[model samples]
Every structure is written in C-alpha cells, then in structure tokens.
Target: MEIAIGVVVGAILAIAGFILGRSSGRSVGLSEGPLAGSPETDDHAALEDRSSSRESELNTVLVEAIGRVSAFLKTNVRKPLIEAGEAAGADELRERIEHALGALSDIDFFLEEPSMSRSGQSLVSLVENVAQEFSGDQDVRLRMQLASSPVRAVVSGPVMMDVLYLILHNASRFGGDSTIDIAVQAIDGRSLILVRDHGPGFSDEALQRAFDPFYSTSAEGLGLGLPHARSLIEQMGGQIELRNVSDGGAEVEVSFPSS
Candidate 1:
C-alpha cells in the first residue's frame, strides 16, 4: 500500500511539472511574436501615411488649377458672349472678345510655376509691339523707354503682366489727349519702372490708400488690380508707389531688387 501511494504522488508531480513548462514556453513565444513582426508593420503604416499626405497635396494643387481655369473661362469667354448678344454690331463684340481672350492668355501664362523673369521683359516688349500696331490709328500715343542695358530682376511673370495691364488700360482709358509714357530705369541699385498717364490725378489721400486691397475709385472695377499688383511686388521683395503729378496726371512707380 505505501509503495503504491508513493508512486501516485510521484506521477502527480511529473504531470504538474510538464503543464508548468508548457505554459512558460507559450508565454515566451507570445512575447517574441510581436517583436518579430513589429518593425515591418510599422514601416508599412508609415508608408501608407506618406502616400495619403502626398495625395492630399496633389488634390489641393489640382483644385487650384481648375478654379483658375474656370474663372478665366467665365470672365473672358462667357460674360463677353452674354454682353455681346444684346449689342448691335457683331464686329465690336468680336474685337472685345479677342482682346479679353488675349489678356486672359497672358494672365494664365504668367501665373504658371517655373516662372521666368525673361517673361517680364517679353511683356514689356509685347506692350511696345501693341502700341506700335495701333500707333497710327489711336489719338493717345503710347511711348516706351526701356532700359538700354538689360535690367534683370527676380519677378513673377503673371503678376508683372497684371500690373502692366492695369496701368496701360487705365492710361489708355483716361489719358484724354496726352500721350502715355513708360520709363524703365535703375535706381538705388534696383530696377525702377514708371508708368505715367496724363489723366485726372488722384488726391494725396487716394494715393496713400490706392494699394490697399479691395480699394478702387471706379464703380465698375473689381477693386483688385492695384492691390494685387502691390502684393505681388512685395512678395518678390519689391515696392510700388503711386503719386500724382503737378501736370495733371498720375504715376505708378515699381521698384525691384536686382537679381
């Protein structure tokens, strides 16, 4: 009987030892499993996050491009069509549409990335060319005095075009019988371009507030042209100022640092 009891006890101790060893082995395996897979899983998750961020950035750029295109179409193409439909002569309408499209194309070209400063010089040339084109027909003469020596500066092509367009348009529209003059010169180690129009001059107060965003004297203006020009000039580390001449005119002076 005693020998049998001792045998039973020994058997129970062996069984308990086996179960404890199995449990310890399972605990050790579980601890190492996550450690073995964690690095790869973390790497995959990081890649996914980066991909998502890139997609979002791409979408934002696409949306901006689409919006600009839509705006151009609406303003240059659609609005003109609607307005011209009610007018008497189709010739005037056609001319207006052509001019609008040309201006819009110029704006689009300038606003694209990889902006070339040469584009600004090209724009000045284009303005002179246009003036020469209509020089014989128009009563108000346009004159350009570009720098004999190249005046190179880092500037956004589109914004420069806009500035030129606004100044020229204003000059042509309001310059009664006087000729519009443009002079590009170097001043204080910077490039200074001045557009002078012999139109009704503005008050000193107006000159001070002229560059403020959304400020305009014209009832029909979008009140963005001058302000936008100023903003762009400032962005390129330049400055613009407006002044009234004693000879009944206004002058827009744009200054840019040499590249």
Candidate 2:
C-alpha cells in the first residue's frame, strides 16, 4: 500500500513538473504548434498566453489530485488500518494509521493554493485540541502550560492544530525517556506556542536541514513534518523557528500574528 501511494505521488509530481516545463518554454514545441514559424514577437505573445493557461491547468490538476488523495485515505487506508489494529491488538497498527493521517494533513496544506478561512479562532481551544490528538492513545504525557487569558490568532484552527501535532509528534519520537513540555501564551498581541523536549539536542546538520522536505534524520521518516508545519504557518501569516536549548533539549517556537 505504501509503495502504491509513493508511485501515485511520484506520477503527480512528474505531471506538475511537465506542466511547469511547458509553461517555461522548455517543452513547448517551437516548430509544431501555434508558435510554429512565428516571428519573435508573435512567439513571445503566444508563449505568454500558454503560460497563463498552463497555470490554470496546473491548479486544476492539483485540486483534482487533492480530492483523489483525500478520498483514497478515507476509503482505503483509514478503515483497513483501524480494523487490522483492532483485530490483531497491536499498537503499531494504530501508530502507522496516525502517521498516514499526518501525511494526508501535510498534502492538504501543501497543495490547495488558496488558504482556508480561519478568522476569529481561539488559540486556547486550538492548543487543547493539539494536546488531545497527540495523546489520543493515552500513552504519551504532554505538559501543557496555557496562558490565563483568551488568545486569538489569525490562522485556520485546523492548520494550527496540525502544526502543534507535528511538533509534539517529533518531540515524543525523539525525546526518549524524557517528558515533553508545551507552553502557550499571548504576548505583544500575538499568540506564541513553544514545544521543548529533553532529548539530545539537534546536531549542526539537523539544525541546517531539519525543515527541508524529504530530509530526515530518522531512516524511516519522510522528513516532511517540519516543512509542512512551516509552510502551513507561513501561509497563515505566522512564523516558526527551531533551535537547540543551551542546557539539553530541542525547542520549537511558533508565533501567530494577531487577527
């Protein structure tokens, strides 16, 4: 199933590249179609038109792919994974399902160019949800330090929730024998959330490439978690930063601009 999904994703990425290549005049034939034998100015004009059309076509392809992937995850992956886990009484099955769900969340945010509506969402509620989702199995302990007052951020609640989940998931996965700590506060009219784990601090290489897509320290990971979190936060007018604490841990700080 994983291989099948990888092939499908690879094909979609190739199609996207091909579309962009044609738009940029690399794959557009100069001697065959509308630009054939045309003067320089005419060729330029035609190319511009093709580029505009190609952009629209590319958006259509991305939207379609998003729909197909969402449907596939719901119908094929989620149900079977849940049932198998229940039948076999294995925690690993549930963990795999959660990881798959996280991947779907990333794809949903990374594609779909238009941002979702997230006006007037309570930061307090968002933080609560994130804590709940990550600790769903009741095994991982999360220490949430929330601010006293209500905090609101100008970002989609779901997007922020996923961001928190990704951060917490990473902290727990690498934390090993240490408890995870999360702090949520409002300062200077912005909502700030910090995640700290008492694990071995990131090495120099990790600090440089931690947020790069497909670059993972773990052999089994796809390395899209931090990248996806960063993209989603920036899209919503927020900022994310990662650093190692001086004492002994890795820290992730997320700031959402006030609505």
Candidate 3:
C-alpha cells in the first residue's frame, strides 16, 4: 500500500511538471513568433488606408472648387469692371477694357456649346477686327499676320478668342506705351502665334509662377488671367509659353496642334 501511494504521488508530480513546461513554452512562442493576423491589426491598417484616401479625395475637391470660383469671379466681376472703365471716359482704359471683355465674351460663348467646329480663317479675322476696333488712341500698335493658307483647327471659338485676347492684353498692359509686334507662323506642324511686348521682362521664377492659379504681382489684380488663359488653350490641345526677349521685353508664344 505504501509503495503504491509513493508511485501515484511521483506520477502526479511528473504530469504537473510537463503541463507547466508546455504552458511556458506556449507563452514564449506567442511573444516572439511571427505575428498572426488579428482583427485589431487588420482594422487599424484599413482605417489608415481609408484616412489617406479620404484626404486625397478632399484635396482634389478643394482644388476644383477653387478653380470654379476663380472662373466665376473673372467672368462676372473682372470683366464688368473693364466695361465700367470704358464708360468712365478713360479712352485708353476703355480700349483695354473692351479688348479684355470681348475676349472674355468669346471664351464664354465658345465654352457654352458642346460640339463646335472652328475655322482658323474666321478666328484670325475676328481677332484682327477686334484689335482694330480697340486700338484707336492707344500708343501700342496692333498687327496680325495670318497664315497664307487657313490653318483649320478643332477648337471652341470663345475659348480660342479668350486665349488670344489674354495674350494681347498682357502685351499691351506691360508694353508701357510701346508698339507690340504680333506675328503668326506655322512651325513643326503647329500653328503658332507670337505676341512680343517691349516691357520689363519677368524673371524665370516669375514666369513659371505666372501659371499658378491666383498668382499675381500687381496688388490690384485678382491673378486669374494667365491661369485662365492657359486652361482655355490647354483644353483645345494647345500650349502657351512666356519668355523674356534679349532686347528688354517679354514674348508670349501660343501653339495649336494642326488639325
């Protein structure tokens, strides 16, 4: 009876030791082993991804909203100011205003239509006619060199008009009562318009920043003119660039893909 009781006690001790060792090994493995996917970790990763995506979407929406607002102000407020200036007996100012307004109107009209075809001849003629109408007393001279052959392009009329007017307006504004040389040429299978103004040229940084939305050097300017012009040109598969001439002025070059 004594031996049997000792044997039973020893057996019970061995069993307990084995269970304790197994339990310790399992705890250590759980602490040092490769991580297993859990609901909590998965939820955290998903939340982070969602947050990043939401932030990106919100930024996009904000940028688009800013653009729309800028457009509205340019059309409704800025253009009207030009018209009002014209009526206020400022002949030079009036001419500038009319030029700007006409360009804005053309852009508005062109964008209002969905499917529109534009004739290169008609566009060139329209621009020349408008320029002549507005160049009455301004010291700056207006000139147009149309292509020998009509360079047909698929464009929204108003958009192209706005682009042209913007370039012309900028040239006149900065040219400081000097003659502006306007020329049109065809190069590299693209129709190109060059507007050169004898004004204080901008630095490389300023030239680059001019394309940014709402960037302006003039305290009175709303700074949407160039950006809007660029948007219109790019919409029609064209490009606009500003470069300082070696003499002492700035030149704006616009290129349109040949249709």
| TM-scores for every predicted model | 0.51, 0.63, 0.55
- Mark the regions of model 1 whose C-alpha exceeds 4 Å error after superposition: 1-140
**What's the candidate order when arranged by decreasing lDDT?**
2, 3, 1
Alpha-carbon shift of residue 98 in model 2 (angstroms): 10
* CA-lDDT, candidates in order: 0.60, 0.73, 0.62
Candidate 3 minimal-lDDT segment of 10 residues: 25-34
Better of 2 and 3 by TM-score: 2
Per-residue lDDT of 1-259 in model 1, one digit per residue for the tens? 2432343344334334433443343223222233446676675556556656655654554444344444554665566667775644878877877866664554443333334354234434544555664455456677788877667566766556556666666666555545889887776678887888887876666677766433456543434467666766777777888888887788888887765
Q: By TM-score, how accurate is candidate 1? A: 0.51
After TM-score superposition, the amount by which residue 129's alpha carbon in candidate 3 deviates from its true location, in angstroms, is 2.6
Find the candidate with the highest lDDT and give its number.
Answer: 2
Model 3 alpha-carbon drift over 4 Å, by segment:
1-123, 136-139
lDDT of 2 by residue, 1-259 (tens): 6654764586468446644554575445544555456566686666768767767877885665445554556555565565664456457776766766665555544544455687878887888887887788436888889888877888887777878888888888876634888898888978888999999978899999887555567654545678778888898889998899988899999998766
In candidate 2, stretches whose alpha carbon ends up further than 4 angstroms from where it belongs are 1-7, 10-115
Q: Write the per-residue lDDT of candidate 3 for residues 117-177, one digit (tens) a residue.
A: 5545444554675577547635567766677765555677766766777677767766664
Query: Which candidate gets the maximum TM-score versus the true structure?
Result: 2
Better of 1 and 3 by TM-score: 3
